[model samples]
Target: MGRPSDIPVWRHIGEAPCPPSGQERVTIAIVGAGPVGLAMALEFGRRGHQVLLLNRPDFISAGSKAICFSKRSLDIFDRLGVGDAIVEKGVSWNVGKVFWGDRPDPVYQFDMLPVKEQKRPGFLNIPQYHVEDILFDAASTLSSIDMRFGHEVTNVLPDDDGVDLEVRTSLNSYKVRADWVIACDGSRSPIRSMLGLEFEGRIFEDNFLIADIRMKGDHPSERWFWFDPPFNPGQSALMHKQPDDIWRLDFQLGWNIDRKAAVAPENVEPLVRAMLGPDVEFSREWYSIYTFQCRRIERFLHGHVIFAGDSAHLVSPFGARGCNGGFADIDNLGWKLDLILRGEAPASFLETYDEEAIVTADENIRNSTRSTDFITPKSETSRAFRDAVLELAQDFPFARPFVNSGRLSTAISYPDSGINTPDMDRWVGGVAPGSPVIDVPIGNRWLLDRLGNRFVVLADGWQGPAPDGVEIIDVGIAAETLQLIRRRFDFSPGAACLIRPDQYVAARWRTPTPALVSDALRRARGLA
Candidate 1:
């Protein structure tokens, strides 16, 4: 990998050469300082808990890694107070075009943002390094967050009451006792390995070469995908424009190629030049070859030790599920851990985090596996079917659904979660009890912006008193906006919804008594 002079580098205030330290005690210890680890530290820090964030690298990070971030990710970042900053620097996009062979025009095109009038765009493309920099900067403002950049965890030993960790630096090793430990390391998690856990899933045989090059590209911000293109025959290709004049390109390379030689500058130059055209000028910044895999550990929570982000699950880069899924993990686990720490919820409450996150990981695996199969067919019959579907997808609306470039990451509903209060009334069209809340505008502000990180009652002129400690969010708006909210939330007169701290609906009803709302609140807190 090569770094250009254009990209900015970030150094943390706590970054320094490693020397020995004395033993210490902390409330929570988070391993890894990538986007997920830093976000995890921020999640706990904002909840008024002391956290120790550890990373192996001296600097934040470099190169073009995990650039595509989904809408759900933006919402999480917004809650963390860095959403506006990310959107300002990222390349926002909504439309995507799919091409077959050397066709002059795209056979089918689609909009990623199906719903209208949302606060954020459908997707944003910014280098992963920028995301880490922003998250670290936000975490620095919190007194509860203590970040160490050049530290590594040598061992993790869980006892009856808490976990003891051995941390190593350049000169010496020291111990830290933590009531709770969070693992946010990359896919190759050192924490998971030390705990003797293993992932279970399939690793696809196909390979893809990624090339990030700088150039004055004519391509629009929209994502462009091609199948069996002339530049790379019998395979698929993808292209996206980043914030800088950098263009990211991916070319399919079958299983049996030399991984080392494939990334050589001499070999990678021809591929980019051929794809761009004979006269195009460009400079390469990075090149790599990699395989795809969909795998996850069986459980995310183990006693006082928990795993999140790439350490918990992994998905192919096609749908941008990698980092987006990580944000989802933080959103789900943060509130639950906060309640448990305060003794408001039992230890068993953390098990739900294990269940819900596994559900999310499994769903992403199933959908991403399907997309991989469509992009890289396994046999002649499958390839023929895929091509036929692509041919008909251009004109036939029916065939469009069968074409699986990627399912594009979305917030999944947890219908079977134990904490969800099952709906007791008939509903028409609204966010369900276990679904993610829909974003709507209220006056000049967005609906989500008003709902802070706490349990609230979203009522529609219900006049019913909410349970203790639960606040009622304002939904009063202009007639047009009110109508939109009513439609999206099915909030007829007297309808009420109970939303959890993580912005997920716990329960809803058309008409409810005070007793019922109390029961739902208790149930959502894992006390019922």
Candidate 2:
């Protein structure tokens, strides 16, 4: 078979020099060059921290492994300086339609981004390799990042102070030391195995076949899912549009089927022809069979070493939680690690990353598990109930809520966390402490852009002096801006809210005072 014209060739870069034994110290060491690892390098390097990024393989990825990038992931990419490039290259959409049986029309449809005005779309579909390329280009320009391709970490030893890693290459073995080590080496992480960590969770019995085919067609750019369709017969399937006329098709194979035979062209081609008509022309770009699982480690933080992305947790692909959840891990850990390295916060602050990420992992696991259960019923009674809900959803509005093809991934809010200050003000319908702030327009700029990379005090009609490290933005002076702010923050004329560096609300007050604001700032930074 000839290679597709659209696929990019992987380039082989030469090996990097092995560091000396005695003087190989750095601030942070990141293992893997995938999206999550590159994100960690970019985030820490942007803040002027010395970062060593190591990758085992010398060549770039060939296929689109993960296609969906959520809005929260895009926002984090924006902060890392590659958001615009990614959005420009990817296909953006927020609508999804679900079909049951041989129906001529969709039984139900949903809009992910209900609000029209926002900084980013609900999600974008781009080849995972393209995202890694963009991140690699950005990381190359940062002087603080030391990128070492083809150097695999053979051993990781963590002590009370820091970690020591033994890296192996084609020519030589070297020692590297770092104050902190982040394991983003993916689901089959060598670092996790080297430390003898146990990842506890359940693996589903169902297997799925994923195929990426390239063709030119008139199909709309939205997610289309079918449950027990006529073309497949007693199986569920999903179809999604990609950027370069490449479409991703997923078919569920029962536990009894042979995985190798199912992915063979003789079998897969017939299914494709049946679904898209016999006359349609398409070429296979990539194909693979995978079993779904939901799992996470006991804790993300271990002494001087930490885990992020697939190294920390794994979820089924139904909710787009795998990559999106990894991005969330980077966002949660980056700022706190930066503060600790700079002595702005205590070392105990790192514990918050563990506490927060565990809760987030639990949330992702629960959602993914529920979606999987609905999609693949283990018992006859469960299957009947699911079918009934799908059948009724076509006509009744109440039944639409019960229809759970797959709950799309959204940002999870942390309302009751130890990091966020307790509410001391009256608010109705807006972001609370520990919740992410919804993006709103301020004049010609965005409210998030004005927040910058530091703590901020957002108030309406303020007449007092601001703190030293905090930026104060007065929103009540203009009618249009104030109205939008009020609607988004549920603010009155004199209300003020403290926002963290990652754009999460830390505290809110009906009346602003220097003492109270300072206390909130200190508590938010782990000074309390």
Candidate 3:
């Protein structure tokens, strides 16, 4: 494919001598250079694993694809060393307003960042290209990540012990063996097709036009959604503010519209002018018509090959679940894959990745499906119900919950996973097994910064020494700190909680013993 004349080309820094045939072996082979693949590379690189990251394209992405980054994704980026840059470059927003047809007032408004004290904002809006650049820069600086741009994977063969890949470059074709292969190739993954994997789910007939424009406007940095608005009659519209004066607009075009004509400048300009006044000057950055689907493969793990991000599952773009869920995949798979590669954990531990990620994908599909159904009613009765909800939402506070513009992606809680230790003692509202650690401030640093990438034993004022391979955190040193800890963890003096490397709580006890802690660690690591 030829590059667009107007788009700027990113420099390629992956030029190097090709490896000799049949002799190259890496601990891991990643099949894409998008956000998920780059993140996988960065995580493994940081852990000192031999990694090869392959991409078919030599240049970076030209336009913003995934614009919304959730707080949980930011936390993952922070752990990978690029969180601050993303936060600094993206437009942070926590408030959203939803309006009904031609009404001068909003029917409902929501605040995503309800709490004042937190490490990251509720979400940020930035072009996906910027995120790729940051991850690419970080990946290039690592010694363990071998980035091979313009190298395409032609075939893959998985075996009991490892996988063999046939790759083609402009110069030559070569074969490489890897202990593990990760397919981050994308929704139209060739690896998936080659492996005869099937993605099963519902495909919505509704089409939407996405336009990114650069303009100077008075619109505040918040999400504004319209249900049957004046600008686009009888359909829903969404507008969001992004960094660099770029604004994203999505206009729903019922399935019958011609996609090519919808994205044409002649048609798109009139829509933009209608929405943003005829006098406002703006230039189009990018435009595309997309049909969304809520789909996923039955399994994410296939022998020695694993799939992440779009290659594993896909969701409608309403709730920003696609990228956020992909980040979750990276977080869940990174440590587990690393441990397995280093022989610290058995290969069967990967079954937990499949179990947990499937649960996450299902949650995303459910929310995205609901949002799609509400936005595009399939029948007259459904439309009437939706309109009725919107109408009542203007006056009745009770009707507001029925409005589902988009739930906005948030962390999914895994309370009943097999890895978690069941509660044996009476406890009130607090972090439980399989729950991500809540962030809290300690003196000058945050609680997350103090926790290591291993098993952690957090205690209020316990004097007993922790078992081997466990890091202890004394939460009772300061009165104010102790108060915050107790409120978050529902803890009294001497209570302890065991936290996993991914920051999920594994177990808690009023009084912990070495035997109990060790057993909990074993269960959490899938060794039990």
Best by lDDT: 3
Model 2, 16-100: lDDT tens digits are 7767657599889999988999999999999999999998876566865899999888888888989999999999989999999
- Per-candidate RMSD, Å: 2.8, 2.9, 1.9
Candidates in descending TM-score order = 3, 2, 1
Q: Lowest-lDDT window of 10 residues in candidate 1? A: 1-10
- Residue 136 Cα positional deviation in candidate 3, in Å, after optimal superposition: 0.6
Q: What is the C-alpha lDDT of each candidate?
A: 0.86, 0.87, 0.87
Cα lDDT of model 1 by residue, 428-508, tens digit: 969998798888887788888878678999888876688878887646653559989988898888888999988899999
Measured with C-alpha atoms, the lDDT of residue 481 in candidate 1 is 94
What is the per-residue lDDT of model 3 for residues 352-376, given as tens digits with 9 covering 90 to 100? 9999889899999999999999999
Q: Mark the regions of model 3 whose C-alpha exceeds 4 Å error after superposition.
A: 1-16, 477-479
Between candidates 1 and 3, which one is better according to TM-score?
Answer: 3
TM-scores, all models, native as reference? 0.96, 0.96, 0.96
Report the number of clashing residue pairs per model. Answer: 0, 0, 0
Candidate 3 backbone clash number: 0
